[model samples]
Target chain A: MSPLLTFFLWSLLKCVVVTVVLLIGVAYTVLLERKLVGRIQNRWGPNRVGPFGLLQPLVDGAKLFLKEELIPGNVYKPLFLIAPIIALGCALISISVVPFGGPFTIWGSPNLFQISDVNFGLLVILGITSIGIYGIALAGWSSNNKFSLLGALRSSAQMISYELALGLSLVGVGMRAGSLNLRVIIESQTSNKGLLSWNIFGGMQFFAFFLYLMAAYAETNRSPFDLPEAESELVAGYHTEYSSMKFAMFFMAEYANMITVGCVATMLFLGGWTSPFGNLVPMPHNTFLLGLVQAFGPIMWFVIKVFSFLFLYVWVRGTLPRFRYDQLMGFGWRVLLPLTILNIVGSSLWFAYHS
Target chain B: MLLIIFILFAGLCLAGAINLLLQTHPINSALSLIVVMVSLAVLYLTLGAEFLAAAQVIVYAGAIMVLFTFVVMLLNAGKEERTLGSFASWSVGFPAVAVILAVIASVLIKSQGLGTVHLSDKITSTQELSAMLFKELVLPFEVTSVLVLIAILGAVALARRGDGERKGGQ
Candidate 1:
């Protein structure tokens, strides 16, 4: 194949595979949240479907697909349709930049795990997510409903506020790694010192990580930060007017955003694609077994780390009560922002002194 | 591929700007402006200024525009009330704007040799930009930060209601 053709084909293949995997992942995430939250509430969640409700997402997807698409007469029609598409599209596109596993040969063709390894993958993810606020905002406004608009507005405000802490928290990770590429960050974390060398272990960014954890919860519109769509207050919030698949898109967007944030946290702090033992685990000499290990091992570790973060998301949702409106904003601005600034300054000095 | 994307997004930018003008409601105009800002970000990416592209999206399209939308939504802004065009708007205003656009287009055409960006001319990485800002341009950067600090203070003072007023409204 011509180089350009090879590049295009490889990218196309990666995009398809990533999108499919991510969509299925998002579906199961919903199932996971329901089941886990159900357990927390002392209930069996969705056991009616195939084998402990593994097929629940499939059933839910079908129902959404077959259901009616309603457009209220009062809606500003064009934006009402476009907002959820943009929301979901932005959520999905952020995945294209995330690194999942190491490179390996596939049927004699050498392939690296990521779709595209941009130099500024982290910032690109940040920028894409920052734009995601539009979906909720436009959804609420275009819905021509007070509750929807209020929900959307609150969500946008929360995201904008928390984004500062989120972005600042990552700077410590990036600075420690000395690179913004997700792959490079992972490589930096593969310490011979085993698990102790991961950013959260001996790394000084633990406080930053804590800050990021809180901000990420708000960013994903999860509970204790989910004031925008709080059932008692906003009455379904931004998606209140949405029905069927339109609502489903917003629902999937939330899960997808959660997954994206989880992946970022894993990549930055928990050592992405690296085993707990780091490079200490001896590799088998057999090429085929090694290949299988290399291919699946990293993916398995990554999924485990990501799953842990998602579990944290659910745990927080179950554990904490949602913050009141002014309290949420106050915490974001008065607390998180100042702490992030302090962290940036402190880390800079720490790095300089250590160097 | 480069030319294709440039044409596609440049057209989008123009379309977005035109939409901003044509939209009746303030919210629609604000969204259109976001479309333009996002298109500009893409243009920056194509021009090999990745940092600027991200900043364009993050700061302009993301932060500032969200605030604009918030205010517009909060006010429940309706479609802009149309007014009768003055005789001078069609005669003097249109021509003046047209002349300005023509001059800009002429300068742009003349600068094609300089503006033509080959793929190899790409400088999308942030290293050089950061180096330039932190090393050679540090003073200006600090000055800008100070300016921003002042602006924040000004905004806070202006927006904060006095203790006497706060309780009365509540």
Candidate 2:
């Protein structure tokens, strides 16, 4: 095969693998949330599906798929059909640029554990996520339902407001790394001091991380900030009119976004796939053993970090009460926005002085 | 490959523009405008202006068009009826646009310095772009930001006045 053909095939294969893994991850995240929240609420969650509800997501998927798809009367046809796709597409697209493991050689060519290593991977993610608001917005509008519209309006306002803080909180990290590339950003966190060198510790970005976490929670419409889909008020929010697989798409998109957010948090603040011990943990000198460790170690660390982050997400969901709509808006703008700006300035000064 | 992608996006951009004009419903038109903005961003990427491309998507297609959609949705605007143009506008607008296009085309064709453009493979990094904006064109950049700030203040002032008048009336 020509070099170009080989490259194309490899990329195609990588895309397939990453996508399948992500979908599985999203499915399992749903199970994890249900189980965790159930435990928190003093009840069992999906115990019968398969061994602690391991097969719950698959069964849920099949049920959603087999259910009757409903296209409500008096709804705008095109946009109603297209909204969930836009949401899910944007959610999945953002993950394409995230690196899950360290680089490894395949077929005499070096490859990162991501589908693409765009120069502005971080910016691409932000842009795609910002675009994702349209999905909820359009879904509500096209649904022609008052509850859906109100939910979407609140969601759009909340998301756009929180996005400012979310984007600004990362500016300090980007400034420290001196690049927008995800891999470079992760590598910049490397240090013999290990956990201390991560942005939240020695980098003095714990405040920014706090801002990012809050904003991320708000951005994903997770607990405490989930005013958009508040069950009491909105009755399922933007996907109110959607049924069957369409509703599943929105559900999957939400979980997928959570996973993506977790991945990004793992990368930006937790030093990515690097161990907390860093170089303190010695590796094997033998080539074969080194290769095996190198291939698996970073990935294991990455999964652990991401899993913990998701646990935190669920924990917060169980612990906190949802913010009122006005409070959500006020906190995003009045509190988070200014603090993030302050963090940028403070980090800039710190980096300059330290350098 | 770049040329093909450019042509595809450029065609989509033009199609979206036409669709924007053709669509009677305000929401559809707004969505078409988004399509135009996104395709144009892709065209910018094809030209190797990565930062500009990202900004176009984030700022124009994502933020601005979203606000446009928000407003349309809030107003619950329906399909507008098509009407024939007035004689005065049809006579003046077409000739004026033609004259402007003619002038631009003539200038481009006649200028010796305006050679055929080539798309280079070299990508423009954000650092270089920032250097140009902050270092070489610092005054203009600051001036532009100040201008935006002024516009924002003017809007706020207008909104506040409207609120005060409403409160006084109440």
Candidate 3:
């Protein structure tokens, strides 16, 4: 094959592999949330299917598939059908730019574990995910249900408001690292030779991380910021009119977005795919077993960090009560946005003074 | 390959603009405008303006359009009342706009369309663009930001219900 064709084929393969893995990851994440939340509430969750609920998601998929897809007479059919797909598509596309592990050579060509490495990877993510709000908004309007419309309106407003804080908070990291490339940011964190270099610990970006955490919860529409889908208030909010696979699409998109937040947090703060102990695990070129160890080492650390973030997400969901709409918007705009702006300024000042 | 993609997006932009003009409801028209904006962003990407493309999506398609949708939904803008087009809009409007565009395109094409200074792929990206903006044109950049801030303030003022309206019964 020509080099251009070979590159295209390789990228296509990566895209497929990443998509499959991410979908599975999204499924298992749902399982994990249910089990964890059930355990928190002193219940067994879904333990019967295929040994400890391993097949539960598959069962859920079948159930959704078999359920009647009711399209109400008043709905704008095309927009209704396309909304969930857009939501899911927007959720999945950002994963292409997230660097999972550092670059390693295949034959002679260099490639990272990520699907693609755009120069403005972080901004691309911000732009793509921001557009995901349209899915919820369109779903709400097309449904012609009053409850769904109100929910969608509130949700879109909340998302766009919180997005400012979310994007601004990350600017601190970009400034500290002096690059917007995800891989470059990760590599920059590894330069301190120990724990001090990570954005959270030594880089003095704790406030930005703190702001990011709070804003991320709202951006993902998780608990405490989930007014858009308050079951008691709006009857399932934007997805109230949806059923079967349509509703399933929204559910999967939410979980996938949560996973994206976890991954981004890990990459930005906890040091992406880097062993904290400083290359203690050697890359064995010859032995199969040791090579596996070497290959999986950074990946394992990356996974561990992301899991910890996800655990925090679930824990926060269980522990905190949902915010009232007025309070949520006020906190997002009046509080988080200003604090994030300050975080950027303070971080830049710190960098300037230190240098 | 890129040419094919460009043609596809260009076709989408034209279709979306026609949809915007044809749609009866304001919300649907807004959505068609979004489609046009997104296709335009893709076109910008093909022209090696990656930062501009991202900003176009983020600022226009994402933020400003969301605001439009919110206002439309809040106000409950139903289907616009249909009316016969006045003779001026149909007879004079389309032809005038087309003539102007044709004149501009002809002028540009006749006068050496562009002076291409080939830049290495990576070097012509967002980093260079930002360097130019922050270093050489920082004053104008700051002034443009202030202009945006004024627009935001005006929007807020317009959205807030006045005290007189609040006091009056609905």
Candidate 4:
């Protein structure tokens, strides 16, 4: 087979696998969030549904599937339908560039864990995340409801505000690493050291890291920054009028975005897949098996780090109160914006002073 | 294969442009504009400009198109039939001139053997593009930023005028 044909098939297969995995993961994430939050609140979450509510997500999935879908009489039918698909598709496309594990040999060919390792992987991810706003905006607008339009407008403004900080915060890391390829960034951290060598602990990169985390939380429309979908204000936010699986798709996109943000945080500041204290061990540096072991060492660590961040997201949801719309906007524009700018300048000065 | 993809993308662009021009509904025209932008991005990809293609989609199709759609919906411009001389005369005239110019330009390029022009693969990558933007195109890029700033200032001025008018009326 031609190389192009091989690449095409490999990408297609990876897409299929990732889609299936994310679907399952999304279902389970809902369960995990509820159970964790329930524990935090000292309340029973969903014990009625099969075995401590292990099957609650499945039941919820079934309910959404069986529920009657609604389209309001005045809504723009085509755009209303297309909006959720766009949201879900863009959410899924971002996973293509994320490296779940190191490369391995398969059928006498080098098989990489990522779908495609583009040189501009960081930029691509940023671009795709930015595009997700349209899905929310369109959904709200197409619904032809006042609440939906207001929600969409709020979401667009909120997303655009935070995205600036998010992009600027990453500039510091990108400058320090001298590469935007995520895999390269991960490899750089591995060769340098482990946890201490990661960008967050590497000099003043932590400031950018902090900014990124806050901006990322806002970007995903998670609680405290989820004013667009605040049930108390706009009913259900952008999906106010959506029912059945269409609503499910929006919910899936939100969790998928949460996972994407977590993965990106892992890659950027958490040493990606590198073991935290791998440098402490006196392993040989040149052996093939040792190299393989070292390469795969970070995968588990990466997942654990990402899961902790995901847990933080749920914990925050249970603990903190949502910000007022004006307060949220002010925080994003006034606080995070200047802080991100300072991070860039500080990183640049450090680079100049050191090198 | 590249040519095939290019032709298909071109067809989509043509269809979208026609829909935008001939359709009576402003909302339909806005949607068609999005289709045109997407097709343009595909055309960029066919030329091996992947970064450019993604930027085209993100900036034009995703951002600007959304703004256009929003404004169209906000205006709530209802459907109306296109009369014979209702903006069609200028539009048709410009397109006719554009076609004539395109035909002349293509003939000149063909006669000059410009079809043999080649682009080196190295110069097409994102790194090279960044280098070119910051180094060679720095002046023009900075000028564009200034232009955008001026446009924003003008918009603010116009908004202030509108507010002043409302206050005067009250």
Judging by lDDT, tell me the better candidate of 3 and 4: 3
The candidate that wins on TM-score is 2
* TM-score, predicted candidate 4 vs. hidden true structure: 0.88
Residues B4-68, candidate 1: write the lDDT tens digits: 99999999999999999988999989989999999999888888888898899999998999999
Query: Candidate 4 docking: what grade?
Result: acceptable
Candidate 2 iRMSD, 1 decimal = 0.7
How accurate locally, in lDDT, is each candidate? Answer: 0.90, 0.91, 0.87, 0.83
| Candidate 4 collision pairs | A273-A298, A274-A298
Candidates in descending TM-score order: 2, 1, 3, 4
RMSD of model 3, in Å?
A: 2.9
Tens digits of per-residue lDDT for model 4, A1-355: 9877877887788778878887887888888899989999999887899988889998999999999988889898988999999899889889889887766656433455677888778878887887788789889888989889888888877887888899889987787677888888887777545678788886468888889988998989999798989999899989999999999999999999988898999898887877788568777677987876756765678778878888989998999999999999999999999999988888999988987
Score residue B135 of candidate 1 by CA lDDT: 100
TM-score for each model: 0.93, 0.97, 0.92, 0.88
For candidate 2, write residues B74-167 as lDDT tens digits.
Answer: 8888789998989999999999999999999999898896654456558889999999999999999999999999999999999999999999
Those runs of model 1 whose alpha carbons end farther than 4 Å from true positions after fitting are: A105-111, B87-119, B161-170
- DockQ metric for all predictions: 0.73, 0.75, 0.70, 0.41
Residue B33 CA error for candidate 3 (Å)? 1.3
Candidate 3: which stretches are off by over 4 Å? A107-109, A280-290, B87-123, B156-161, B164-170
Writing each residue's lDDT as its tens digit, candidate 4 over B42-67 gives 78766667678778876776567667
| Chain A (candidate 4) TM-score to true chain A | 0.94
lDDT against true structure, model 2: 0.91
